[model samples]
Target chain A: MLTTLKQHIEQLVPLTDAEFAQIASFFTEKKFKKHQFLIQEGEAAPYEFFVVKGLVKAYHTDTDGKTHILQFGQEQWWITDYQAFYSGATATLAIDCIEDTHVLCITRANRELLCANQRKMEQFYLKKSSFGYMALQRRILSLLTTNAKERYEQLLLQYPGLINRVPKTLIAAYLGLSRETLSRLS
Target chain B: MLTTLKQHIEQLVPLTDAEFAQIASFFTEKKFKKHQFLIQEGEAAPYEFFVVKGLVKAYHTDTDGKTHILQFGQEQWWITDYQAFYSGATATLAIDCIEDTHVLCITRANRELLCANQRKMEQFYLKKSSFGYMALQRRILSLLTTNAKERYEQLLLQYPGLINRVPKTLIAAYLGLSRETLSRLS
Candidate 1:
């Protein structure tokens, strides 16, 4: 799992062995069973997770008890209630395991210290955050312009294997389509 | 205008006068009339702007000829086709002036050089990127869970003065609400 973390960071910015050791010391690994809650909505998020194996989703439950899928995390993906984690606010999203999972976790303080001490880690994080921003920018455009069918199609094209990895109903929720409409589109 | 830039940067991370001069040297000031294009959709975006005065908006026009506003930029705000600017892709959005505007522009290369040379600027950019990501995360949730009226209300709450600064029709488009529906709600 730690090897995966090293590779993920290296994929963004190559690091020296000594530097990798320094970054590795800041993270702790944890495992969760399928359906386990990693963090709950409306609560403070203490840490961010980097997935090494299995699947997890960040989502929201509305006042009417409808679930809205925000993001999914798989191997090499990072997931967290970023607003809560960064701003010290309560989370507006919850994350739970879609399958038994392993993740490397880092607290806000440790992540900051790592960045301050390791310029390479700061560059890696900066790149990740910028990429994440671009992705969300595209997602907002899709939501604003595309219909449910087009959105479903675009999602398929972007994440070809996601249809197989995620349950159909959850995908429907992610696309903001009713289950019947999603079934028809699928 | 440069004073505003200094204050904006200093708000996030304080710097010496020498540091501010290094940061400011990379930017060039430009002025645009209302209705001028910053960068058109489907073209390369060469620069990102920091608004000094007046107003601007980033928008997407769908194939069906409907316009959807992506973001608004006012005093001290950063505006650009971020996906294109960051990735060297053709813009998926166009940014144009809503009123006569003055802005400080920076090319991608200069931005990279600035971050490479200045640790404080890198820190500033990282903080800005993370904040932008969190804002987008909340936006995605709003799109998924809220109705148009609720979205409009939330927008009003978030940007209290925006309603008065922007034209009503543009606000309607931004909220993905029909002009008639927005009129009724507003």
Candidate 2:
């Protein structure tokens, strides 16, 4: 798991052995069973998780009990209620394990301290945030311009293995299509 | 205009006058007339603009010739075809002046150099990108969970003066509401 993290960070900025050891001290590892909640709505989101194994999803449950999927975290992906994490607000999005999972977790304070001390880590995070913004921009464009069918196709193309990994109903929800509509499209 | 840029940067990260001057040297000021293209589809996006005055919007026109609003840039806001700017791709979105506009423009190469040289500016940009990501997350949620009327009300709350400044048709387009529907809601 630490190797995965080291490789992920090194993709953006190479780290010395001493630097990696120091960085590793800031994060702790945790595991969850499938269907267990990593974060719950209305509770403080104390840490952001970097998935070392398995899958999780962050979603909002509307008043009508409809689940709106905000994002999914698979191996090597980072997941959290970022607004809540950064602002110290209660989580609006709940994250739960889609499969039995292991993740490396870092609190906001530690993450900030790490960045303040390390220019390389700061650069890595800056790049990650920019790419995250770009991905969301693309999602917004797809929502605004594409029909359900086209959205499904776009999602499939963007995350090639996602269709097989995620349930069709959840995929439908993610694309803002009904299960019937998504079935037809598929 | 430089004062505005300086103030904007200072809000996130305080800088000495000498530091500000060095930072300002990397940006060039440009002006545009209303409806003039700041960026056009299929063209290279060479610079990202920080609006010092007036308004601009970025939108994508689909194959069917329908326009989808991505974002609006008012005073003190940043605007660019970010995917193109960062990835060296041709622009998919067109950004145009909604009012006569003035902006400070920075090329990607200069931005990289600035961040490499200035820790304060790098911190400022990281903070800006994180906030940008959070705003997009909210927009995604609004699109997923809210009706057009609800979205319009949320937008009104978020940018109180925007309705008066922008045309009703454009506002309608931005909210994904038909002109008649937006008129009725208003």
Complex DockQ per candidate:
0.91, 0.91
Model 1 clash tally? 0
Candidate 1's residue-wise lDDT over A1-186, tens digit each? 788888888888988889899999999999999999899887889999999998999999989999999988888899999989988889888999999999999999999999999998889999999999989988988999999889999998876688898989999889988999999988
Give fnat of each prediction, in order.
Answer: 0.86, 0.86
lDDT of 2 by residue, A85-178 (tens): 9999999999999889999999999999999988898999999999999999999999888898889899988777878888988887788788
Clashing pairs in 1: none
Candidate 1 TM-score restricted to chain A: 0.97
Query: Which parts of model 1 have CA positions greater than 4 angstroms off?
Result: none
Global lDDT of model 2: 0.93
Q: Model 2 in CAPRI terms: which quality?
A: high
* Candidate 1 CAPRI grade: high
- Residue A180, model 1: Cα distance from true site in angstroms: 0.7
lDDT of 2 by residue, B1-186 (tens): 899999999999999999999999999999999999999999999999999999999999999888889999999999999999999999999999999999999999999999999999999999999999999999999999999888999999987788888999889778877899998999
RMSD to the true structure for each prediction, in A, is 1.1, 0.9
User: TM-score, each model?
Assistant: 0.98, 0.98
